[model samples]
Target: MREVFQQELREVQDRLVEIAELVAISIDKATRAFNESDVSLAEEVIAEDPRIDQATVALDELAITILARQQPVARDLRIVVSALRISASLERMGDLSTHISQLARYRFPDKVVPKSLRSTFAEMGALDVEIANKLTSLLRSEDVQLAEEIRNEDDKVDALHLSVFDKVLGEKWKGEAVDTVDATLASRYHERFADHAVAIAKMVQYLATGDWDQSAA
Candidate 1:
């Protein structure tokens, strides 16, 4: 029984790594679609989002089954619980990537943001992609240093998010109302993607350090 339970726990970690890999691919493609106005890539991201959703649902069910069968305690319990929360965050990150692609699809041949803000959005998108990739590594290796790096990148995303607002609200702004709305939504999507990555990193860090404070979440 002990051997079987340990195997189940390893399975949980493996599934998480799989889901994180999907999220990394998602953000990569979504950001490219957003930057290049590639409707086909955008469509791909939207279509594949269901896979991320399904993966998360399956992981949640597996975690619940482990909880019921093994009645995990102490660190074992934390592993199962954190897996659930981390899966949720990864799913949200996937959704945000879909949202970014949706914006690109909506804009179609037209760029999502005006020339003035394109570079900023591009920078934010790159940071989000980097964060997602780092998150996947952190999950697989349990490297707490990656978690801090994720947080730092998230701060950069937040700064860019605010800059988007500042530009749109500034008197010099010349974009149409539609452009304003699109820029705001896209920036938000990018920022939130990084935020979810940070959340997952914190959960992983806490799990590794045995500092399982609920507040770490």
Candidate 2:
């Protein structure tokens, strides 16, 4: 029974990692759509949400199966529970990425968008990709220290957001104020993207130590 339970745990975890990887790709594709001014890619990210949703459901089923069949006890119970919570967080991250894609479709077609801000948006997108990739690594390693590193790394995205805001939301924008809306939404997307990354890290930490901290990082 012990060995069987352990095998189930490994299978669930591996599937969790796979789910994380696909969501990361969704984020990257959505960001790329923004940078490249490609509406098709943006639509692709939005369409991918069903996959994330399906994965979340599948994970829940796996956890329930373990709970019913093997009767997980103590630590095993906690890990299985954490797996459900982590999958939900991962699904939210996927939704946030889709939000970015939707914004790109809203703004880019009219050519009112400034050419100068492209690099800043690209930087934001790149940071989001990094966050997603790091979370994927954390999915496998589940190391507390590495999770801290990802939490700390969020500052970069925040700084990039500030820089974009200072430049675009100004008198020097010279009545080109519609861009403000674009910048504001972009800032929010990146900020929330980093927040979800940190959330995943926290979930991993909980799985490892059986100690979950809401205030973590």
Candidate 3:
């Protein structure tokens, strides 16, 4: 890669990292909005989503321009293509978080999510945070091993998602109606946010090892 192409690619990479960080914070805030029923926080998450969306679009355009002008090959090509796809996923994850936040407004603020399902949501929130941290680590360390570990890390979020469903249904089975269905739907959104982080990890792994794995889906 020429110096100019390398410089452009670096700029795209940095912008993508910015998008990831913003979306990660959005996910965290959205999860809290659901758990605590804080409409202000949910609204904030929704409001900030456009930042991620715009960043993704700008970064993608720059990347595409680089691909057209430079015609990079091998590692340089992988980095640009991977970053483009990663940015798209991050933007979608931001949208998912905003969707979750919107759902929390379906009911009154005083209403609490069922006690049986709260723990699972709490766990999912922590896992989402951890998954975000892991992606940050991958960027810093370029650790393929750590990136691969992210797939396993995502399973923890999946488990939490499943457990929330189980708890909600189990409570419903015990004659407790699901009055707060919003949180249940919100839990799935958080779970998908973690899933996007896993997609980034898979791309990171491919960047390092050139192995294609559809299992991240």
Which ranges of candidate 2 are over 4 A from the true structure? 110-113, 175-177
What is candidate 1's lDDT per residue for 101-157, written digit by digit as tens? 999999999989999898998899899989989988999899999999999999999
- Inter-residue clash pairs, candidate 3: none
Residue range 1-217, candidate 2, lDDT tens digits: 8999899999999988999899889989988887777888889999989999999999999999999999887878878887887888888888888888888787666532477777877887888888888888888888678788787778888888888778776656643657778777777887888887887788788778878697743
Please report how far candidate 3 places residue 150 from its true position, in Å: 2.1
lDDT tens digits, residue span 1-217, model 3:
5999978976876787777788778878877887788989989998999888889889989988998999999888889888888888888888998887787655546544666667777788777877777786776566988786778888888887887777666645442344446656667777788888888888888777878787743
Model 3 scores what on Cα lDDT?
A: 0.78
What is the overall TM-score of model 1 with all chains considered together? 0.97
Error of 2 at 208 (Å): 2.4
Worst 10 residues of 3 by lDDT: 171-180
Ranking by TM-score: 1, 3, 2
**Which pairs clash in model 2?**
none
Which predicted model would earn the best lDDT? 1
* Model 1 root-mean-square deviation: 1.0
Of the candidates shown, which would achieve the greatest TM-score relative to the real structure? 1
Name the lDDT value of residue 69 in candidate 1.
99
